[model samples]
Target: MTKTVRIALQGLTCDGCVSSLTTAFMTNPAVESVTVTREPSQATVTYNSAETTPEALCSLVDDAGFEGTVSES
Candidate 1:
């Protein structure tokens, strides 16, 4: 099933950060879409739940050098 993951991001300094993250998330085959906002420091990722988990998405953000938490939309 497809699920949307609302992520609260921290330490997003610039547009570069957003772009970088967008690219990183897009690389995941299971991810259907991603929307990131800098002012609010949050991201919405739509993906196939059967292929990926919320924790994995959060870890992806963390591994990219940003802090993130997953929440329900």
Candidate 2:
């Protein structure tokens, strides 16, 4: 099954940050889609839950040099 998660992000400054975060999410083969917005400083990611977890996704953002936390909603 696939799962979608909203990750609140920090340290996003420009379009480049968006692109970078998007790329970081896509690097995971289980990721189906990623939408990042600088205005909201968040990313919506869809992925195969069987293959990846929300914690793992957040780690990717952290590895990319940003802070990422799963939204409660």
Among the numbered candidates, top TM-score falls to 2
Give one digit per residue, the lDDT tens place, for model 2 in 15-51. Answer: 9999999999999999999999987889999999999
Model 2 TM-score (2 dp): 0.97
Worst ten in a row by lDDT for model 2? 38-47
Candidate 1 residue lDDT tens string, 1-73: 9989899999899999999999988988999999998988999999999999989999999999999998667
In angstroms, the error of model 2 at 12 is 0.2
Model 2 per-residue lDDT at 12: 98
Per-model TM-score versus the true fold: 0.94, 0.97
Those runs of model 2 whose alpha carbons end farther than 4 Å from true positions after fitting are: none
**What's the lDDT of the predicted structure labeled candidate 1?**
0.92
lDDT of each: 0.92, 0.95
